[model samples]
Target chain A: MSSTPTALPDPMTLREVYQQQQPYTRMTPLLVSESLSKLIHGDVLVKAESLQKTGAFKFRGAIYRLLLLTPEQKQQGVTAYSSGNFARGLAAAGKILNVKVTLVMPADAPENKIASAKKLGANVVLCQQMEPSREEAAQKLSEDIANQNGSILLHPFDDPEIIKGQSAVGVELMQQLQQQQINCQSLLCPVGGGSLVAGCSLLFDPFHTSTQVFGVEPEGYAGMNQSLLVNHLSRAPGKNLSHCDALLARSPGKANFEVVRQTSVKGLRVSEHFVVEAVQIAFEELKLVLEPSGAIALGALMQYPAQFRGQTVVAIATGGNVDKALFTELVNK
Target chain B: MSSTPTALPDPMTLREVYQQQQPYTRMTPLLVSESLSKLIHGDVLVKAESLQKTGAFKFRGAIYRLLLLTPEQKQQGVTAYSSGNFARGLAAAGKILNVKVTLVMPADAPENKIASAKKLGANVVLCQQMEPSREEAAQKLSEDIANQNGSILLHPFDDPEIIKGQSAVGVELMQQLQQQQINCQSLLCPVGGGSLVAGCSLLFDPFHTSTQVFGVEPEGYAGMNQSLLVNHLSRAPGKNLSHCDALLARSPGKANFEVVRQTSVKGLRVSEHFVVEAVQIAFEELKLVLEPSGAIALGALMQYPAQFRGQTVVAIATGGNVDKALFTELVNK
Candidate 1:
């Protein structure tokens, strides 16, 4: 391993990125609930990315990444692998920017997601997740497409550009908190591929030094937490076993984990049952539709209230791209 | 009844109400969807007032009405006879402004809504709706409270201030349409007491005559449509009821119905099945959690595509305050 650190992207530059990109992206409200504040024994502000375009914060990074592409890159088009929120975000961004997007999903990825991607004008390629040679199959598909069509892979979290783009979220949060005159003592966000958390860490690092950042993970896929402890990205807990497949990243990004380790942040693992309960609360009380992964922050708040009391906390409700059928199942149950 | 026409409130002065009340009231997104456009066979824009504070467009009127109250009036407190969204909105706005709110809900009203009002610091007064005498009971309660506490009666839809306040939605739609550069041919909204439709009509009448303003009503409670045709708010359809209890008004506001009748726009009477299906679609596709009334515009579009095709149309998603248990029941069914 190299002893020297890679040049970390400048937080100021990310702020600039936010300024430039805000017209295209939404400045989602950071609303504090007097009722919720009293419930948790703290002032709680919700950074409602639930209202973000494509119903998640992924659109922010996806828009920035697509916007920054060169004329040649734009012509060559972009590729991303996900059957989830990011894929939808990329597809929507691609459609708006008039760029072509090719998304690769496991064959069993929710039909709704596939339909949504297609609706947004993406060429969807589906491969079975259960096949013995699936991982190899996906890799070969990516390489063969890249070779033939000169496409660029828009990795969900690992790319430096994507991380820098995601950092815009933190920049917005800091500015919004200040504008609202809210003194946030802590920030909580669900950790999936660490793109959103990494961006937040970078943005929160330069200001509010005492503000602790926390990432929440569904129990079966605490890769980011494990990786931060070991000082490297590590494998996901099990082979495609987590119900929160969005959070089932095989490893955290090296740069992302490094930022998390350096940012005075901690990770909390929430049980799947708690995630479902949080989702129910959000749907029933908050009148917000949150996917299981999207509800992880709420799960942490619900499951562990003592750790967060008296602190002005902000929770990043990452996305609302649950399969509608899954929501019916959860809510109905 | 007064023989003279009810004077329309001035829109210019209404701008001040919007400025004062909009901070607490959400200017919920006016989203244009391609999928809904395809389904409706025209461009479809949704003014998602369902996402408003207190989960409905009712907040706009309630907050504005509260702002207009004199210091003496505020000190005396306010009261309303509502078993639905208005109760929650009034309670929430009152909590923010330190005004006392007394809500009279039917004992049979959804438990969740009653709980929400209580949780938001409202004085909850319940009356039984099971008997024919319940209306007289409500009137007596209102009179008793008014005499005892000097409380102002906050009628849900009939008040001039309330109607004018809700007109801000029309103003917002106009502004957003300009910003989005969309020339809508028609506006569709759900009609319960006719306040939302009246407000919208005020905008479309002299301001944007080219744009027709339509209202959707549940077949179970199409009193506004009936009132428009008969030239009087009536209760003939009161026997035909709705599980969408928020929309079960027996009569339209006389003043508001007068305006709704003058519009060139038509009404669409849709079934409960379409409303349920539309709510499902809103949750599933648009990532919006709308109450049954909120989903009716979409329902109308889904049921009567031929009437809306080839024109730019905007739908008012009236509210998003469905009870969780009821939501579960509806989604499950």
Candidate 2:
């Protein structure tokens, strides 16, 4: 009888990822607070991706993809599609590596992102809304470039290498906890493409503690929950419902979903209204700007206080690259 | 024949002031930058007063006044005037120090500041604005409070101890410069009431090098500049032209003014239009929110970039608590 080989227990070793990716990515601190602890009825720590270079955690995956390139590939450069954080990250990384880049962005991307990418010397391509999705339009552009000039396409997530790279955040989190001598009961992170949570689970698996990890998604974009319940894959990359434009992954990453399925982690969804309230609370109380997607974990904490009470929890404060106009709209309203 | 003792090189050593007053004050960091170096033509560093706890440097002097209170004085609490940073600082410090504070504010004071003061547990006494000088009415309130119950009055500036406490920013700056091993050619700080620039001069004076200190004042509030030409004090505190409301300080501190006069520093005034532009640049380029007063130095940089072309300069980004509504109004326009 023939048996299928067991999948690797670890997606990638923490040490190897650190050595390969540490130079390019930020070691965003796991900031803990006495005040936050008191309010949440437990010790609370925030992995401040808002403070990450380029103002988002997307840099970790983008830079990791850049690192795997051959010198020739580096010279030829790469291309990707994102309307927001990823666009900024790829452009920024391209500027640092002195590599030419082509970006396929939605025509309605934030002006700041467009200007920032242009400032970093990326040849930005505007796509029509006629395409069903920005991701599909971008994939088509990537294929065209691959056929014509053999340029590499850097997928934002769903790529195994990118998933492995995002796992570095977990490694950093564990290292930081050890340094501070603080033991956490659970890890709470926002789910976008599911790669971040998927990669995190692999890192947490070896600890062998009953420390449960939870992934939060905006209520409208919680495709991961439905996928996990029935084990059926969705056709696309984002969920159908989301006021948070960033967290609208229609489907989870296949590899990441596999890892997340095996881990003893629970997933939860938060309402768009709660996310807005969380954003306001962050500004008024913590003096932080948490974009709608970034506030999902905090929104869960506020909406369901009992679920998190008495547990030492770590929440990822994902990013702070808010459009000035959108920020005014939300804050003023 | 007898003569009064000559003033000490640095009168009223503020080391003790800083130590005892620290709890009541927010120790704003003097953040040095590599990015700013590209614009100022030298190694440009920003002392980010914009990041101060109450979002301005005025908190330093307000807290210093509160800290210097005698036991009897502390029991009765404190009172002050103005509808800007000082009001906010007094309220915040008063809450922490367990002192009751009553502020005489103009009816036109930004709703944000008034609300912030109320949130911090200060009693607000709104006054009519028909009077040409609101400072006069504030002084009257301070006197009445002193006469009735011996409540201490905290002046926005023009107090020696306040000047001494404000000097601590200078102290921190010199230490930061030394730690970074950067030999700064000059220090440029906004000249509001002159306390900030004056205090900074004292801090820079002890360096034993020919370091020029410059002050940037809003064009409308050029009281300090006019005063400098005549070698005579001009415009009583809070009685002068007010464009940058936070910098409406008419008179420089006597000791602070003396230091500015004695030092080899220059003063430059930038237009309001340029100030708005600088504030925009701050938001776009530096990813910071700066009030008009806070952006005055950046305004100066835009107006006369050549002046800073070759020298290692430090510009104090002195405040950031602009009314969000006002900021939207100005920037959107």
Candidate 3:
């Protein structure tokens, strides 16, 4: 893989994108966690993107991606593959923008995710092949559908436009921190294919800011962490099972990895046990319903509290689209 | 009971209280519900107080009540009786203000609520008496304790200052609605002892604004609803079981009822089944964790969609202090 990367979006462009999406996107509350703050002996803030439209930060990217579509592309529509969050976001965005959206999801994806996507007026095709991984199989199916229908193909997280769109989360977080007069020392974001972290990292001036950004991933799917360690793109071994269905991507997207590599983003992996505990903590303490993937950043904090101890920290709770049964089982555990 | 009431606080006073408490309180997000809007053929916005500090709007009133205490009262501390939400809120408020708090709670209150109050540094006493109603029994026990210790007795919902503090919710809602240019026709608040409804009602001018304020209650615990209909205070029959633990108060507090009665606030009630469904809907659609009592207002909208059809509406989701077992049970159902 090439080590060199394309230029990232400047802060001005990021702000412009954010301003354009401001009316459509929700300004999710930046909540201070008393319990976590006490535990870590520092201020712990949660940027609850789980409360965003379509129950995830993906909606920002999805909406922006659709808005940037060429007139012809918008008319023809778009297709994409996602385990859940992005599919729902894109489906809703498509509905809002009057663009046709087709989603290819794994056959075994959470029932609620599939149902929500369909309910949002997406044409959903379930891919049953799990031999080469559900994500890859679904991506292949989506590409085939796009080719057949002459629709533009959308990558759930790897695209530059999508990453630019995801930067709105970072833009909003910076604004909130400024408003609250908070100077956070550390920032944590959950990484699936790394679009959220990649986009967010673009906002902080690594040369001047003391803030250290971390891309947190589940243990089995620590591809981003591995790639960051090796200083090159790498795939996760994918040997272990995890409940974070949304963070099961085997590798970071090329565009996302490129952006992250150009920034000062460190990668951290959290155990499955801690991810479940994070979900429960979010429910009990933060009063937020976070999926395992969304809670992964907080899970990293719990897993490595000493590293962030006595330092103001911000954790992005990226999504809350977990299946009811899984959420119940995890919280109960 | 006498219908004549004490003078209500004006809008300026309400805004003053809100400003004083603004720095301490969370400006919880006002979320638009596409599903609910489609169901009623109107714009439905949810004021998610479930995301408030101590996981309920009770924190607003609790903090304000403690702030208003004299130096002697602060030094001597205070005592109150509540099923759960107010206990947790008061305990948290006391912790923040460095005031000692003692709470008398019904023995059967949810385990999480009791645990949270204790965790917040409150001295908790469980009242086992059920003959005169759990709320009355607890109130008596708290009064006895207050008298013995010379600590001031605080009414959980009946106090005028507390109502003024809770008016912050309405104040914030109006600001958010104004910012969004939304002119909602109806406002619904979950009614327990009715402080929230009364406080919010004071903000909307009955003689000017066309918006109708509603105090929504569980079917069996419709004390506030019944009182509003009869133009005086009344007690609920309290013969049926309900999951709305926070809203089991047999009658409205005198101050709350008086304030509500002076306004044009109507009453609405929803069944146990719909309250459970509202919790599920809040979880699925709004990505919010709402306790049964917190969800009753949304339940009212679900129960009476015809009445709110084609009109913009706002429902205050008051709290998210439910136990894990019950929340799991309700959402799963």
Candidate 4:
């Protein structure tokens, strides 16, 4: 899947992506919070990707995906579907590379995210879909837009190169751990299309055998968790009004599911109720601003600390694009 | 003043402090926010010390101060007085070093900061001083406590060791800018007792003449500005009620003013109204949680961008120990 006319796919370790990303990426800090440690009764190393370029880990994948495009593909530009973080990440990446990019976001997506993407110079189209989920509707519109405009189709989290690009986070995390001389017992990442978790799982795979990776999802939209349980791409009932707008995918991406299925992905489902508290904890204790979806992995740890007791765990705080009004309300409450 | 520091503080470059802090410090990212750049039509690099240990750059100084303590001093313990960030930093540092730390804080200081310091296992004394200023009263109490306990009295900011330690922020910034091949035109830091700005000025001295260091203060408490203008430690009229509790020092430290005076520190005074907006900017655009004092340096840039127009400016976001209630009010309104 990593094979390109110019580069081989499988041998293309995240190390190469890491090298390519050096020019654009901020080495997000791995921080240990005393308050968080006290809460969980163990050490919790927070990988603050909330401070990543475009304010999310999605940018790592977005930039890498754009970088790997064939010259012919770059000439035509790229189109993708994202609710928020990916949209902003791709828009920023496209602007950086001087590539024409189009994004399909749900009409109901956070206004701040939509506005930020437009400001970043992306052609943004809002898809009006609510039957299964806005994400599916956005996906359909993005596919049509790509076909009509003759642009290369970019899956927000499905394609192998994108997953490979996303895996750069895991690679960087591993290197940081090694440098600190600390061995992690488990790594928690919030999963949407399962790309981040699947990619992380690959890096901490059986060969590394040192740390277990767990994907976290909101209870209703636990697509990756459901899929893993069923050993197939399963659809989740995405009917709940979750503040985690970024993780509203009704089903895991096909390619993402394939990778997770092979990798034996373990996932824990978290309810929406704990999200605001998690966000609050980030702002108050961790001095980080995280969107609801971005705070889910921390939410997982906070809601179920006993499971990780006595083990050093790292929770990936993935994004920080919450709208001012909503963020005000969430944190205030 | 740089002598013996009990330990040769003049030779105690920030590089050495940086090395000492490797075990506890997070190399806070120097982020270029594209959104922030477009807002002011200038390049602004954010040194996110909001993510530093104890959620502030004060931790850098606190830890370094604690680390350099003589064995006798360590055995006797230490005492310092701070309204907020320094209290937390010193408390956390003391916890790590197994020293009994005592902190004297204003009775009216932010509840969150008080709670956090207590949580870090410090002996907290709330000073009942609303006249002259909470700071002076706290200092008087701290002196009494030191005498009574026979512990080493630590100056929160005036001590050369603490100032030398805080200079590590400047050193890190220079390294980050060098790595990105960025030649910063001006570096901005929020000033209280002036330790941070004083330390920063030493490194970006006549040697690295390209970058000018500017210390920012809230309008009513621009003591460093007044002090620099007079070539001595001058007290400002501290009458305003502002949210920047962490930066409420009515006068810059005598030693700190001496260093900044020699270094020719440039100063900018920002109104309290603009500080809330800067806090909002950090929350929304930068994905960082910054206390009013921490965001004041960025506030200076935002309130007066014309001065930094068409040039690259690096603003130090010093801390993020803001109360949720205050944060909600600042961001919401």
Candidate 5:
């Protein structure tokens, strides 16, 4: 696939993708954080994608992906598997475009996410937990369903199309920052399959020479961090306790890892405790509600403030779709 | 004063205020709520000023007020009184403009409010709860401080300039709505001293012809509501066991009420129960953390859904500065 691969797309193509998706998406605010600026002694901007359609940034990629489908393919529909965020995003996108979408999700996915996907008219198949990660199990089941229904199978994050769609975040952020005359020194993004970070790093530092862009992941599931350290795709010990259900991907996507290496994306690992604290801080200071995975990039700041002090930074809040009880418990804690 | 009353300003003045305040404040997002749209069967845009600087719409007025002070007045500084939101807004505004500020507050004001004022280098005088009302007592002390210090005594929400400054919210909202091609049929703004609603009503329906803009107040502190019912200023029973600390004004401001009467602004009163529910829903559905007073306008919808079921509505989430403990309890409940 690498030998015959197409050349990486240019920035204009990415910007066009963002512009096309504008009608189907909300241009989430680029909010300046006063409390964070005081803490860092520099400007801190939050790209609040938590307020995006379906309450996550995944909708950008999902909608863009569906828009690119051929007329026949759209009529035939598509199949995919996701933990939660991607499922809701894809479901909503499919519903909007009048395309049938079948999703295979883990049985233990959040109730609200599952309910939201079903409400958006997605046919959901709940896969039981299995070896090689619940995601892999769901993926295998999704492939089988796609074959049975003679439908196109779409990868949630590994596909180049998905990565290109995710580039909308970088394009939008750069547009907003330029309008405000803010030159960001560092950017932090929560990494699951690494698509968002990879897409953004390509835009912010295509040559991988400067502009520190860090991908934050939970401690035990820091596959992107581990992979970057050895300069190769590597798996992490994903069998640890974590509240960030959306960020438990054991390994980065193959295409995503390739882009990260090319763009020199840095990685950070945060503990659940810091993630919980970040959620509370987001609610209190930022006035935004972020799920644990969504707050991990913020946790990276709290975990190592000295490293970023006096540097202009931007953090991407990825999703906000936790169950009310879980959200309350995290807030109380 | 009414013998030759100062003429009310025009929309050009309001747009200029927003332009001048652009650098000092955030262009808060005008977000369409998908969940809310589904519930109401029409569009529901949330003009979230909760993410505004110093955590409320009061900052727009406070900063514009300070910017408008005469050179001598700016050097001498200013004195004002507030329950919580205005004090923080004015203090922060003064600090930014290098003007000394003195604030008179009720002794029982929120701890965070007092700390925020002091942190911004404001001299705070805590007035004891005496006869009349806590706000009235604070107002009297503020006047004395202004006279002793030879400082300008600024009303929190009474002056015409202050009203014009607060008009930024309406101007900004209209710009956003027009960009989206959305015709706002109904607008809901939480009312304390009535600046926000008055400014917005004037912009949307100056001749009292169309566009129903409602001033929402707490159940017992419905001073703006009571005042608009008659054609004259009237007081409300502000004594209530509620947690909306930022909205305890016993009566609408003199100038604010006059503007409301001219604009033919309508009003609504919400119970504390729905306010709490709105806060929780904000966390759950909208991915925003709104203070109870900020969430009261959303509560107006929950209180009487029938009145606004099929209309395009916009609710103003005014501030996001409630105590963490109180927020947690409210979210948990």
Candidate 6:
């Protein structure tokens, strides 16, 4: 169900959002991975958003969304639903901006994520219903809460303003690449509901540069890839279990899909094994902790090396919020 | 034994070395740890040298050492002995500079460290002797190799030039602190033969600023602390075992001790349990993978929070090159 194509934000708008968020956001290092480069026979630079505030890129969007709120809306507070990363990010942003945040998170969300959100002073409601899906159940509860309180309801990745805020990753990457004199041939982003890829693709599109943008997803949850192929909204099979808990969304958001469609963003799906291997590699070689969801894009590059051989590529590591037990099991295994 | 006080390098000299090494080294992020800050009722900033080339701050010293070599010396190559981090860093630096590096590492050194040194194209010779100590045995072997081959022998931490090279961390940190406008009252550095602490103390000393510097060591291997207390070079008891394999040196280097003494740096010791807990805390809160040696500074902060209460402090995370099994056990435990 596609509406009229939404216009991409102008370059000026992207810069304005980035400048506003600069003070709060960390300029995460763009680290060159010599080991990964040798494996692919090309340059592989990882933008470590895993080191970002709240341990994820989701903080950028969350903070920007709160900044866009009216003075009255700020006073009224906001509500949102997240599996983990977004919940913690929003809670942290709310703490920084002195706004109250209410989060509805799945009961099975990683314990650390839940604890961190509550630690940041967010009122968290545990959603136990997994009938349709955990995400949908939590989303419904958050909406109900917002309706009752008359506070703003923010989507994790579907809103245009959130997309604009996430585009700051691209803005920062471009500046870093320029400083390093790197001519990037491909840019890879881990996609769940596709906000990160959609926003990054818009900035690194044909109109702006010749960089081929890719949205990488786990094999079973490849809705973004499927939707891009058909040029329409689609659902993932969701038939297989995966360790990438943060990236199990069944479908891409309509707003995100529309943006990726217009920007000609490509998609790739990686196996669970490769995602775990990527996480381990990040630990051993790059000395960075990456959640499985965050390492997925790097896994895609490893899974399909021929496509990027002899070219400079950038992979956006989305988050680092996995539980200790899961991370230990994956890395040790 | 104590030697004449070593003159500290002038700021201009430190700047020159930093400028020369900046292109090859990563300007790792200076992350403000909100959790740590809240715990101590003060701000705590972590300089993540764990993200440095070769996954440790040793790479900064290694590269700088190689750069300072004369053409003839570079052609003849160099030899050194280390337990792990220094070996890996020197090997990687040799690969970059096209110099032949021969390393003598303890046979019991971490498997990943030995493998990485070999992978980086160094001629690695494992020393099985642990009579006096693993480090001493390896050092003797390295010296013999250098004598036979007519190659220059390098002291991993005792050399004045190498300490100067490691001072780049201080130069970079000072600039970052200024940018963030943080008036750091205390600086903590992990000590292995005291090179890092000595280098940093020279920069943050009373002659330059009022910052109090501390060298953090494992309780059993607190050689730097013992040496500083008696105002003479002394040896650690070496009676207790520790997981901080990279920081088991029984004594601070004479050159390093002299520098620290001249700078009036203090020392702190953390127990093995606290070191292990610090590793887990770094993983969970900072989203950084730190080897026990690298995490010792953070451990010092946690162990003696009262010492730094209500003060802006900086802790240097020195490395992240532990084997997967060890890291898993530590983080999971």
lDDT of each: 0.77, 0.70, 0.91, 0.86, 0.88, 0.91
For candidate 1, what is the lDDT?
0.77
**Which rank order by DockQ, best down to worst?**
6, 3, 4, 5, 1, 2
Write out the backbone clash pairs for model 3. none
Q: Residue A8 in candidate 4 has what lDDT?
A: 22
TM-score per prediction, in order, is 0.88, 0.82, 0.98, 0.94, 0.95, 0.98
Tens-digit lDDT string for candidate 4 (B125-238): 999976778888899999999999999999999888888889889888888888788988888989999999988988776554688889899999999999778766688999
Writing each residue's lDDT as its tens digit, candidate 6 over B272-323 gives 9989988998899889999999998888888889989999999999999999
Q: Name model 1 segments beyond 4 Å from true.
A: A1-3, A15-27, A33-35, A70-77, A96-100, A119-121, A129-141, A144-150, A207-211, A239-242, A261-264, B67-77, B130-151, B171-183, B208-210, B258-266
- lDDT per residue for candidate 1 within A122-197, as digits (tens), equals 9988866543333335545656666677798767777777887878878988887787677887788888778888
Candidate 1 residues B1-333, lDDT tens each?
553565666667667667778788666677655668988667987788876777788888998999988999999999887857888889999999999999888787777778889999999989875444333366467667777878998788877778888888998888788887788887888987778888878877735468888878899578777766766666634565566667777677777776666554466788888899888877775667888888898888888888888989888988878876667666656
Model 3, position B237, has a per-residue lDDT of 91
lDDT of 2 by residue, B1-333 (tens): 112222434533756666666654444444333345666667766676665667677777777777778878889888778657778888888877788888877777667677888888888888774355555566676667666766777766766677777777777667667876878887778887788777777667634666778888877566687677776666633433444766655556566676667654577878888788867665554445677888788778778778878778777888777777876666665
Candidate 4 deviant stretches above 4 angstroms: A1-12, B1-12, B39-42
Clash pairs, model 6 backbone: none
User: Tens digits of per-residue lDDT for model 5 on B152-184?
Assistant: 999999888888888899999989988888887
lDDT of candidate 5 over A122-159, digit per residue (tens):
99999996678988899999999999999899999998
For model 2 chain A, the run of ten residues with the poorest summed lDDT: A1-10
CA lDDT, candidate 1, residue B221: 75
lDDT by residue (A234-306, candidate 3, tens digit) is 9998889898889999999999998888897998999998899899999998889998999988888888889
Model 5: CA > 4 A from native? A1-6, A206-210, B1-6, B206-210
Clashing pairs in 4: A2-A9, A3-A9, B4-B7
Off-target runs (Cα >4 Å) in candidate 6 are: A1-3, B1-3
After the best TM-score superposition of candidate 2, give how far the Cα of residue A116 lies from its true spot, in angstroms: 1.9
Between candidates 5 and 6, the one scoring higher on DockQ is: 6
